[model samples]
Target chain A: MEKHRSAPTLDDVAKMADVSTATVSRCLNSPDRVVEATRKRVLTAIETLGYTPNFAARVMAVKRSFTIGAIIPTMENAIFARGLQSFQEELHQRGYTLLVSSSAYKPEIEEEQIRTLIARGADGLLLIGHDRDPKIYDFLSQRKIPALVAWSYLPDSKLPSIGFDNRAAMFDLASHVIGLGHTQIGVISGLVDGNDRARLRVQGIRDAVSSSGLEAGNLTLVETSYEIENGAKAFRDLMNADPPPTAILCGNDVLAAGALRQAQEMGLDVPGHVSITGFDDIELARIVSPALTTVHVPHREMGRKAALQLVEMVENQTAGTGEQLSTRIVNRPSLGKPALG
Target chain B: MEKHRSAPTLDDVAKMADVSTATVSRCLNSPDRVVEATRKRVLTAIETLGYTPNFAARVMAVKRSFTIGAIIPTMENAIFARGLQSFQEELHQRGYTLLVSSSAYKPEIEEEQIRTLIARGADGLLLIGHDRDPKIYDFLSQRKIPALVAWSYLPDSKLPSIGFDNRAAMFDLASHVIGLGHTQIGVISGLVDGNDRARLRVQGIRDAVSSSGLEAGNLTLVETSYEIENGAKAFRDLMNADPPPTAILCGNDVLAAGALRQAQEMGLDVPGHVSITGFDDIELARIVSPALTTVHVPHREMGRKAALQLVEMVENQTAGTGEQLSTRIVNRPSLGKPALG
Candidate 1:
């Protein structure tokens, strides 16, 4: 093994290249400003000395990291993956790097991660929703850190967000199912507390029920965490009730996939005996048997938009403004007219 | 909106609390080292002023961040999610934070991320697979930044790894399938050019074929990326061959799921018309109809072990040692005796 040497610094590179420390810094940060011959000398010296511009020292100098941090609810599923990929790609195109952490859908953990990112000198943050404690917002304000919310949109939210209207999207899907003559319906929702998206989705179902001249209170609602196993269990329990529903609506694609699998296991013929609808057309929606009818949220587009909007806020120090994307229903094999008649 | 004010500094906190700056730092970092009364006074002053200790200054002082960075291939799948969650949990228990970035399976992007993470003062890094530019290893060695590779193990690699033997695991799965009297087999492998895991897996199948008294070179193989749609296309092409395979083995569960879905779409019965097997018993394996007969890697265990080993390296300046975990073949309904006449 080679003998250990202390990590190189800017001054060492300057001394080796016989140039001022500022010239070495310019070569590293903005090479275009340096003359080509001198730049080659500085770069060659940097390579020989193995010098990495200390990010901490640079952060101290410019008060900017050019790095953005994002804290999402979960990484267990691909629901957030596409959008985040686009977000990172866009940020990269504009000379920014992204670091991400999973909060596991816990608000306190999310807040702690936010503070950790801020303390690490993240130029800005991208949050998932707008349901965190007000104190957390106040802290971000006091620290003058800009953050943009994604995955759910609110016109009057405390934090500017770039996403779709979850409530309206779900409502439109529900009304379409009802328009197909599904009167007796069951809903499997994700946990609603601190999840504005889930809560809004449930409310949308109720809105559809009321508009279709049905008793909204009569809807069979099962609240569970977002997991495939949970979705299967909820589906089984819902079917056990007296006069089981003809159609089942789930909060997202994962749950809908579980319901589809369990339905097959129970020897139930999809759309022939019952129908199912899912939200968020992740790949899971199509991979399962009897492909799911779902609301297609433009995840990639939302991600790209969020990145563009977030960079605007970070560079300009202007708070992000809300932008609502649109979603449409994708009618696949899983949905059909109820067989009640 | 409130007007912005200059951010509070360490001097301001010391002046407000009427204590030395070092005392204020002790109160924030090591409260047990200070008197309770004085600690309370300093904390109160900090709260009143809402001071956030600048992370750059602190890094400059101690030369450590207590933050670890992991760069993996993709977050678009759950293959890395479960293991990464456990990795993060273990790091948190040891008073460390984890930040992750995806390399999208590109060597240049991965090297860029590794450099960026190191420059950001990450105490250590976790990488995937042992295949990379040798210069990267030299760079890391010169910088003395500890790193551990996961998901594939090599006994004499440049970096220590904590993972299972991919070639052996896939060989076992293939031999089991062959034992079911499957002479005609088709393989849907991930692109093997730069990925050792995929290359080793393909080699494992070839090993099993030769050991079974079959011509390994004659085995039908289709190469594609790890996407469901690609798997479906590969499976279709394989089935369209002159002599259709009695069994189809996939690189991983994602590919297996796609093959199964496409099989159903083509109106072929699983385990009867064609047996299919997968590697990596991810959630996709169980969720897919017929369930996947595959190799079950100790993902969570590997993650926990990697964390423990990497932290030891970072703290003690000790070089990492390779640890190999085992994998087992999980027999599910997807595999059965070949149906060739």
Candidate 2:
């Protein structure tokens, strides 16, 4: 085996430049503090020696990683992809690297990831949704680690949240469907046990149905994982009920797209036979047939805000206690008047 | 201003535990080398002090970061999301943290990210494809960083790539379309300049068309970015031809999904007025109406292999030269016999 090599260190560069170690460190850490001639000599020595400042050492001195860690539920779909891309870009512009990890929708995994990021010395953290064990929050607080939540917003939440109002956003979209004379509504929702976003969105639809003078029992609900096939299966089962719904409202575009395709496969004409709606108006909503009517969360804006807020907290040690974003409905062709009784 | 707190060091833990500094370091770095009784006492002191190991100091001492870095083109869609998720999981299982950065399809940004990862002392790197400048290879070689390429496979490429054959996979799918007697085919390809996989896939389709005695010029081609909106606009342009092709082939399912929806909106029956096929066979392909017929790349397998190869190269200092995975066509409901002339 070839002999192992060592990386050039600050001491080597300082020795090569014939400067005090403090001068070399100051040149690298705060060039403005060093004389131009001395800084030039230090830089040349650094370049010639190929001395790269160890990130951990630099982070230790500055008390910042210039890194932000985000933990989300999953990345198997495009739901969070667009927003996250924007988030990362924003961080890049702010001179930070975005480190992301998926929790596979498990709270335990998310907790573990939080600990890992902290261990890795992330200056700030971006969490998805405002739901987690209180112990996690206490741990973060005790450690003084700045954390921001995205994807769903709660004004009453303790953490700084940069996301849309899930319940109100869904309620607005569902009201439109209810106004279209859809009394019988079947719902295909993402499993919501640990996801406040999914749960709140489902409740928003239920509230809309009840407020429209329809009995709560008139609405049928099927809970499934966030997969297109699962959505299709749930839609098929819902249609087999004694009284099929005139419209199907899904928790998100992924499920809505699936239900729409499954309805087409079953020979049902959308809107003409059954209307379908979704939330989070991802690209799929517009790319699907008839174009889905859904709530358009300002995903890019949310991402940008989350990145900025987290960075601010990390850099300035400013407490990020409360921040909220808004959401609205995007009325597309998928929702229309229900077929006559 | 709030009082600033500092992370506890090995010396701090040693002072608190009434143990030698070497003993504290050994207790944290190589607990087995220390007496069990002393190790327990040191660990308890560390826990009480809330002392997490300094990652940088550990890297300097052990020459290991236990971290891997990956740089990809984009994260705005499911393009690299699923495969990357699997790759990160594999890294986690092996006790490593995966740090990912997106270059937005720019080579310069990718180079910057590579240098950043190296500066951060990443043990290994996972790159998207084999299109970077030779200087990058030199930098990795100089640093002795074990790097692996993914998403596209080239049997004789200089890099060790754990990906599927993009060209042959698309060729097989194109041959299936040709066998269906579709004389004229419209191609919606991703911008292929910096993307070897997209370029090769397009070449494969052209090869199949030429070999089948079909005039390659008769195949209409529209190059666009990988976006649903671009796919819709491209489909519109293709359909407006004096003699629109009887079939449309898209570089990926996101594009194909857009084309299918546009065709439906234009009141044309898919596989009736025109057949549509996609690549990558992502979940969207199966979820879309008509079920896109496309090539299935072994995404998870490739991800796992890439992780394993990179880890091996890092841990065992093994040199990985070249490797390739297989791809196959998935015959779904989208493709059917061309409409009778």
Candidate 3:
């Protein structure tokens, strides 16, 4: 087809078919409502002129796009891959298309993406964390857009959230390491600013340290982005300390994997010289050498539940509620008795 | 605001603002085209009534959405993550929003997603690989949507592609292995049925074998999905052969990481017992134990270039051209001399 000087409009199609614009709209949106002969005529005109129904106008007329938008933190790691995969699959099963945007862990970018999705007539939105500015919630409320928060669950949250308690899960993992006769400890955590999950995980480690009859301040804590190279640098800094902690608790499996790799490269025997533990029993946990001792969050279940609950809220126009899932510790060879100094 | 009985349409906004429907549309679409006082009254009404502009109608009116859609095979791994991240950044710089859909490597799903994105008014599309039904191309052509293929560049391709030659890259890696005295080689590749990248890579290895005075038939090939677990399973099956190859080459780093993990589990030393090489120098290549000898793909460069080229095609309405980058073998400790039998 030759390039059109301008796109075919409803008026052009209406003029060609000798029908009103309303008739064209009805033929496109509700074909069964129109007469068969009129519908055929309109369809023929639309084909001849290549008239596509305007997405925004259709959404405005019908008040539905059957599209759900999700804004995630980062796609650079497999941490959220499996869960988000399940979330979209469930959405598809319920006859909804999903639009995903990655924010690269930047809150400002996420806000822009959220606004962009809303402007695209997204039926509802899925946000990764509940730590954004309250103004965003106000905007969503004013726009009457239903949003579901995933990856971090807060029972008293103003928004509906479906996830495991990050603090409690990390606490359990840290306590298990404590029970394994590890006295000194080090922690490598994700950046905590505006991240409730990271902050809560760090708090969990502190609670575990205090409960184990050690000063929380005694633990060496290093904060870094969720990357393998960053995790390696953090691990090295923690190891070069005057007296290194016998056990290192990583914020997630990716960080823990990084620490394990660093340990291997430095000729250190894991669980023999320095024990390393992780949270989030993603595939990375099992793939790393010696495996990883981690807290297993039910990623698939969380994703599926988020999708079902968000769809229910959008379709039924009901207030969403938080559903807290449980995480269990998966003991692997990565953590064991600390070696004598 | 209380929940509305029905969505506020353009007519509702016009009636509330005491203006005509055309005036309301003009105010929303082109505020500069409207006077300040009139724009103010329309904006207030829109806020009070929560009126959303129709997406489809706007596209038909302006013929521009400033939105680009990409359909990638999978996001379960970091293989496409870095490249796509760069692409989005470049698009953002060009004042465009990116909408991404994962096809899960299914052609039907990809086609459906393509239609959905197009219906949503994507100004252009970025698709991975060149293997898709010709009908999809015809559909895009009919719609006059500018489409770009990436991750597999062909000099004489009908579609514009920005990527390195997958086959040539793999062939060079294979020839390098042959030069290292690795006569017996095993292949663990991504499923090549509808993936030109994977098929071309396998062919590249065959080319190297024949050119090096070795029988291409002697290279044991096992095809599976681009998954770590699948790679491990394929590695084990290949090792169970009458006499296993001393060198194993994987289509991507994810597969090679799996092979290395399996080798460690099977009590085989990497590069010492058997050399394993991989394509795609993703982070997994370096993070894996012993590191991976893999071909370094210019992920960020390809992503940036694809964005620049696709935007040029969409805005200029120009027939796009393919740009091929080069790949280099990153020598880590994964490959070594074959043991003397």
Candidate 4:
């Protein structure tokens, strides 16, 4: 520990390799410009001295850090894990490092993280969802920072996104549920205050309700944070109505798993006493008993494409085009015909 | 976009605010050194110009980034999510930013990420486990960077950690299983090659089998990556044995959930035809049918403590003390006595 009191500088490497500092710098920045034998000597000296090329100096010289930052809602569940993994893997293949930070579903925290990432020299950013303060877009624009949004697609939004339409996907799922000979329906939705996905999903169900010539007032709606326990509580509240709805649709799989558990605790058989559905075919969707019927968004495709497009935008300074992905409903045991009267 | 083609420099802020470059620099770096009236003018100019202070220059001048980097094995599941969320929350309250990267359970990736984080000027690091190449520890030591380990505790390790003992926790759970009058046991474990936690857990079960006077050969073990499908496959492999083990102990709840699902598919009644158990009672444990008998870890506590200790090490330049957190066995319907022969 005493021997390595100070980090060896570029000068130390130059001295060790018996070369000028210019030669060391050239070898590091443009290896092809230097002869192989001379570059080898400099590299060997660098390794022996354990000298790390100064990242700060390099960033200043090249005006690019080759680091991309991603800000997600929460890391408390597996919802964003799979997609983020694919995104990171894709970025790594492209020679970019990914730095991730979770905002815990708070707009203020997300805003702060955006600034933090920028302050930390991120060349580009991957933001989740298109719903945020417009000033944030102005901030990024003023700084010429390229940011790409994922998870929810809004074609005409100020930002470019590679994602699926939450509203239309849920509309399709709701239409299927309504077609299954069920008139009464309930919804367990995530808080819609800041989440466009949850709000659009609820609207989709409402659209299905009205399209089927049913009274919109008859649909029971409960909004809560996305959690298993919250799902169970919302399920209870929906069931306690004078006449419980025949089917319940959850905003995501985590909430659906909770609803399933609460139904078991209540001794009510799923799809027998009530049918339940969820969006996002995460592993939790299938692991639950009766296996959740869900809307399968192409998570990996969105992640991989988002990475590819964001990197291109960063490198080429283009206002990248937004591409909309499609989703399909997964039919499973959790959804069935309402019990015979 | 054409008007703002180039970024506004410090000179631009100085000219706009009618202050010298030194005053503008002082206002940005140490506001107390400047007058409030002048500081406000400079700040307003900065906001109008959207001048982001160069992070690289600041890091070089101050020799600190106030950013902590954490590398986890995988973000593909909820195993580490809960704890990481807590860790990030705590770091936020301390005025420090957290940058995270996932290794996808690959050691080489973890090693590369360590270098990346250091190069990008992380003031400190939070590593998931103590197991890694010894040279990596030497590298960190040579750079004089403080790194704290979390998730798995090893008291004698070179690095300090705030985590629970995987071996003791699993041994307690295994002992409880053996006491339930089970003579034959099956273990579904995560691959132990690069993971100390997985290796320790398998060893704990082996110790429990021997302590109970059962032939070690009777305790069948199948190792696979941590995934639900792998767990199901491993379960099938274990059950194919002649006179299959009466009980199956999964490394974690995710695996246990898969095994339980497969058992249902195979038409085997849990705790009736064969008892099953799990470890690390994540939310999935209770969400599964029959619930899961598993070990409950203090995930949030460990995360919060890890943050507090790591921050102290970074801020005060102290060698932080390691802490061992305790875990308990949570009895659920999944584990029971072997059916009478």
Taking all chains together, each candidate's TM-score versus the true structure is: 0.90, 0.85, 0.86, 0.90
DockQ of each: 0.63, 0.48, 0.43, 0.66
Per-prediction backbone clash count: 0, 0, 7, 0
Each model's lDDT: 0.87, 0.82, 0.86, 0.87
Per-residue accuracy of model 4 over B77-122 as CA lDDT, tens digit each? 8998889888988887776778899998888779778877887778
Candidate 1 per-residue lDDT over residues B163-200, each given as its tens digit: 98999999899988888898889999998977999999
Answer with 1 or 2, whichever has the higher TM-score: 1
Ranking by DockQ: 4, 1, 2, 3
lDDT of 2 by residue, A1-341 (tens): 89857877778888899998777767654456788999999989987987766665556446565667888888788888878988988887776777777788988668767866676667889999877898788878988899988898787786878887788888888888888778888899999998999999998888888788889988999999988888789889999987898889898899888888888889988888888888887888877777898888888888888888888888788877555677777888888897778
Candidate 4: stretches off by over 4 Å: A1-46, A60-62, B1-53, B56-63
- Residue pairs with clashing backbones, model 4: none
Give the per-residue lDDT of model 3 (tens digit) for B162-227: 998999999999999999898889999899988999999999999999999998666999999999
> What are the per-candidate TM-scores when only chain A is compared?
0.91, 0.89, 0.86, 0.89
- Residue-level lDDT tens digits of model 4 in A79-118: 9988999999888777677889999899978987887788
List where candidate 1 sits over 4 angstroms from the true fold: A1-46, A60-63, B1-46, B60-63
Chain B TM-score, candidate 1?
0.89
Candidate 2: list runs displaced more than 4 Å.
Answer: A1-53, A60-63, B1-49, B57-63, B240-243, B336-341
lDDT of 4 at A72: 95
Question: For every candidate, what is the interface RMSD in angstroms?
Answer: 1.4, 2.3, 2.3, 1.4
Point to the candidate with the largest lDDT.
4
Model 1 lDDT per residue over A6-94, tens place: 77777788899999887776666445678999999998998898777667555654556667899999988888998998998888776
